[model samples]
Target: MFKTIKNDLPASIVVFFVALPLCLGIALASGAPLFSGLIAGIIGGIVVGSLSGSKIGVSGPAAGLAAIVLTAIGTLGGYQNFLVAVVLGGIIQLLFGVLRAGVIGYYFPSSVIKGMLTGIGIIIILKQIPHFFGYDANPEGDFAFFQVDGENTFSDLFKTLKYITPGSALIGIMGLGILILWEKVLTKKAKIFKLIQGPLVAVVVGIIFYAITKSNDTLAIAQSHLVTVPIPEDTSSFFAQFSFPNFSVITKPEIWIVAFTIALVASLETLLCVEATDKLDPHKNVTPTNRELLAQGTGNILSGLIGGLPITQVIVRSSANIQSGGVSKMSAIIHGFFLLISVIVIPKLLNMIPLSVLAAILLVVGYKLAKPKLFKQMYDLGWKQSVPFTVTVLGIVFIDLLYGIGLGLGVGIIVILLKSYQNSHFLHIEDKSNGKHKIKMSFAEEVTFFNKGAILKELDSLPRDTYLELNLMNTRYLDNDVIEILEDFAVKAKERHIDIKLVSKRGVVENPESFIEFFRTRPKSNLSLS
Candidate 1:
């Protein structure tokens, strides 16, 4: 882990900057104690980071769960009650890991995955625009289309025009300029620039700008437009931030329902991040998905016990880690330590960093993710890939993260079925074999119920008094549904005076007695018949 400190250390700093406001913002949005977000972020970075197999993915309190957390907090009676649900959710996630439900991430289409990344990128840009211009009515981490602020994503843009702060906007613009110059020019000029990182420099400069202009009225940044780390005065006050879950509430059926909801949503989000971040990793490391759920489960459990929001593998932080040149999980762990140390040592100092400056940093991150080239790239892949990709993007922008993915996934399934229906079988005809029309139909490697219609259509259209060769030599999986279709066709073939010959890797059969009976001797998935 220490081997890549040169790369990981600077990368961790960038992730720390990216994570700070997000923690506070998501906490505020969730209607939980602001400190709870920090606790979750710290645990996510430290505990989940240590346990997870992912080298690049970062975990934290997610904006995606803000609505659920808010509602559960009210419905479950109180914040303390919600903590019980969080703990139970962690346990449920652990079971999901044990059951290997992490494989669900793998089944998502590549188009949908790419769309997710691009969609998130677009959202970051849209969500941060108001913050960048010094209009921060909505919390920084609220990624949903309809916000707790009672405004939608686009409405906030107009609101920004009404309430823009001059000083905050100035620093934000400068910060963005510095980031662009550092990344595009300064980093190439010297080693020190890369070591310091652009986002860290932008944040420091924003703080300095905030400090110097404090006395100026028109140019002064407002308290609302700055990072708001809880400033605990004494040691006891600092420790007082932690809250324990009320285990007595665990008996409530409502608690169990909330727990299951958190478990399912958090686990799904984590698995998606695992897949997305792996795609972003320059090293191309494959994260062990099941282990990730276990890590997340453990992190959530610990976080809930110590007064924290539920945790998930967060793509924004993970992508920031990767883009900042993180080489291993050490970066994530180091960032967690940074959060822990900052909240303890310099909460006031952190509070001085203008939110707009962080918005600038995120703007760049967002641009990198939603670059114009990806749209055309997806489009070039054709509608089969592009349709779901487009749908996912639109859904994310107009709806929310999970809903967008669900919509895209639904479209993706339809595309798959269409492909399956078309590619189920191949046909060839040998002219006049023994004065009969001789035709050969070869099934695809894996024929399922989706192919039932196509296979039946082909068989029904076959001329009477014909010789049919049913080839399964290359097939590996034949669904029971398709087998039944073939069996019924075989019985009808005798009356049509069509000679049926079945050929497979096992052996040839002429007028087979029962296709079902034949495959019954094989394994459940019919692997042995292949």
Candidate 2:
């Protein structure tokens, strides 16, 4: 891991900057003490990062969990009591790892997964626009359509325009321009630019802007518009920030319910992010999913014990790490150290940076995730792949993360069933002479109950005076449901004046005694179509 320190260190700094506001913002959204988010960030980085198989994925307090945490905290009595659930949740996740439940992550369709990444990217961009323009009405990191502040995502954007702060807009726009220039020009022109990223430069410039405009009334940025890390007046006050879980609530049934909920949700989110991170990894490394669950479980246990929110592998930080060129787990571990040291050694200096600058940085991240070309690409794949992808994107954009994924998966399953119905069997009309028709039907290699409807429809459509040949020449497995349909169709063939020829490995049978009796009397080895 240390071999890539040079690459990881720079990327870690960028992740550190990106993670700071998110930690605080998620905590704010969760209705928990702001410091709890920072603690989870610290543990998610140092503890989980060290143990996780993922080289580039970063774990932390997730925005996805904010709603759950908020409700759990309220129902469980208080934040301290809620910590008990977090700890138990970690234990359950560890058990899930032991049970090899991580395989469930692979069951999600690729279309839905891609949709999630794109949807999240779009959400980040839309949510950050308000912060970028200097309107801080919504707390930073609240990406849901319906925000906790009684305002929706689009409505807040309109509201931001009415009360924009000129200073914030100036710094944010300049910060974005600098980042773009640094990436496109400076990196190629000078070694110094490559060594130091644009985000770090943007932050330094933002701090300077804050200081320069301190005395100006109209151009000055408010304290609320800047990063807000809780500052401790002394060492004791710093230690006081950490809280211990209320162990007395361990036996409560409600506590167990919340624990299971967190375990399930956090594990699922972590596994999804793991897949996303692996896909985004430049080396295409596959992380061991079960180990990741174990690592996250351990991180959550320690975090809850010390009064931190539940932890999950978050895509935003992981994507930023990958985009910033993180090459190893060292990036994630080092970023955690940066978070710890920043709050302890330079809390005041950290507080001087503007939230709008961070928003600008995330805007770039968001654009990369939801590039317009991707929409065109998905559309060209045909509706079988495109419909679920489109639904997943819209679901995440308008509803929330989990619901959108569910909707997309639902659509994807329907597409599969439709295709199955269309591909079940092949039918041909061989002869239509005088007033008689000869029809031949061939079953697919493998036919299931889903093929029942199409076969039944064809049988029901047969004309009178037709000669029907039921062919199982290629069938290897015929489901009982389809077998029943064939048996019932044979009985009805006599009434329609249709002469039936049953063909299989058992040889031809003319007007078989009974479909079920013929099958029951046939030898097992001769049952399959040759």
Candidate maximizing lDDT: 1
lDDT agreement with native, every candidate: 0.93, 0.91
Question: For each predicted model, how many residue pairs clash, with residues at least 3 apart or on different chains?
Answer: 0, 0
Model 2 stretches with alpha carbons more than 4 Å out: 433-436, 471-474, 502-510, 521-530
Q: How accurate is candidate 2 locally (lDDT)?
A: 0.91
Residues 1-530 of candidate 2: C-alpha lDDT, one tens digit per residue: 89998789989999999999999999999999999999999999999999999999999999989999999999999999999999999999999999999988898888888999999999999999999989988776577889898889899889988989999999999999999999989999998887799999999999999999978998899998999999999999999999999999899999999999999999999998888788889999999999999999999999999989999999999999999889999999999999999999999999999999999999999998999999999999999989999999999999999899889999998998899898888889998887889889888888888988998998899889988888887887777778778778778888888888888876787774655576666446634435
- The C-alpha TM-scores of every prediction are 0.94, 0.95
Report the C-alpha displacement of residue 80, candidate 2, in angstroms. 0.7
Worst 10 residues of 1 by lDDT: 511-520
